[model samples]
Target: MHDDHDHHHHDHHGHDHHHDNRYSDMQARVRALETVLSEKGLIDPGAIDAIVEAYETKIGPRNGAHVVAKAWTDPDFADWLKRDATAAIASLGYTGRQGEHMRALFNTPETHNLVVCTLCSCYPWSVLGLPPVWYKAPAYRSRAVIDPRGVLAEFGVTLPEEKKIRVWDSTAELRYLVIPERPEGTEGLAEEELAGLVSRDAMIGSAIAGAAS
Candidate 1:
C-alpha cells in the first residue's frame, strides 16, 4: 500500500532575499516586544523560552518518536498510518490544532522524503511541537523545493547519487511527517527503545533516522 507523492523537483533558481528579510524582521519585532514586556514585568521571557524549549526538544518530538517507533514494530499500525494518518495518529492521542490533518511519508532505500511549507510555516505542532526556525526561514522553504539534494546536504544527509528525493508541500489544512526507514541492527529493539532513535530533524526529513544515536 502507498500514497500519491510528488517525484519531480522544481527547477526554480535563486533565493528570495526579500522574503527572508521580511521573516527576519518579524522575528526581530517579536523579540523586541518580548523585551518590552519583560522590562515592564508583564511577561517572563525565561519562562516563555523554557516552554518553547520543551516543545522544541522534549515533549512534542517525543510524541512523534513514539508514533514512529510503533510503526516500526507493528505492521498493522504502519498500514493504518499509510491509509489514514490523521485517524491513526489521533488514535494514539496526539490530536491538537495544526495536527488534525496528517500524512505519513515512508522513506525507502531508493527514495527519501522532505517536507516544507513554501508559503508559510505550516507545521504539525501537536506532534512536532514548535517548528524549527530554519523550517520557517525563506531560504529553506524555497530551496527545499528547488534544490532538495543541496538542502539535504546542508543538513548532513547525503544520500547516494542514485537515490531519489521527493519533496512534500505542507499546507494549513494538511501537514506531513516523514517515517524514516528503520536502521540496521535494530531488529530486536522494543517500541520504546526504537523511539530513542527518532529525532525532530529526522521526522522533518532533514536528517536520517537513527543518525542521532
Candidate 2:
C-alpha cells in the first residue's frame, strides 16, 4: 500500500511539473516573438523598457485621451480618423515607431471592440503611451483571445448580451486603437475637459468612459 501511494504521488508531481514546463515554454515563445518583431522594426526593443518605465513613473494616458476627445467633438476629424487612422493620428502629432501602422476601431451600441496581442504585447506608444504590466502578461494574452468577455468582466466591464464583442489581435505590422463611446453629460465640456474623462482602460476596451465626477 505504501509503494502504491508513493507511485500515485509521484505521478501527480510529474503532472504538475509538466504544466509548469508548458507555461514556461509559452513565456519563452512570447519573448522570442518580441525579439523578432524588434529586429523587424515592428517593436522598439530599447524603447520597450524605457517607455514602460516612463509611463509607469511619469507619463500618463493623456495622449490617447486627447485623441478620443477630439474625435468626439470634431466631426470632420472623426471622418478623417475613420478614413485614415495613421495619417489622422499623425496630424495630431501623435506618431511613433509601433504606432506607424494604426487602425481605429470604434465602439457602438451594437458592438464592442477589444485589442490584444496574442503573440506579443504590440501597443501604440505614441497614443496610449505605454502598455500596462497586465497587458504583457501571459495569462492576459492567452485569456484575452480565449475568453474576452470574462477578461473584460474582471476589469469591471460588463456588456449587454445583445452587444457583440470583437477582439482585434495586434501584430508586429499593425496595431489597433479602440475608440470608446463618448459618455453623456459632457456636451457642454470643452475638448480638453472631455479628454479628461477618457481612461487608458477605456481605450484598451477593458472599460467604458465613466461620466466625469
- How many residue pairs clash (N, CA or C atoms closer than 3 angstroms) in each of the candidate models, in the order given? 0, 0
Worst 10 residues of 1 by lDDT: 1-10
Local accuracy of candidate 2 as per-residue lDDT tens digits, 49-156: 786676676545787888899999999999998998888888987776643588889999999999999888998777897799999999999998899999988887
What's the CA error at residue 27 for candidate 1, in Å? 12
Poorest stretch of ten by lDDT in candidate 2: 1-10
Candidate 1 C-alpha lDDT tens digits along 1-213: 112232344347744343322335666677689779889999975777776676656668889999999999999999999999999999998885543589999999999999999989998887888888999999999999999999999988899999999999998889999999999999999999999999999999999989952
lDDT of 2: 0.82
> What's the distance in Å from true for residue 136, model 1?
0.8
In candidate 1, residue 104 scores what lDDT? 94
lDDT of 1: 0.87
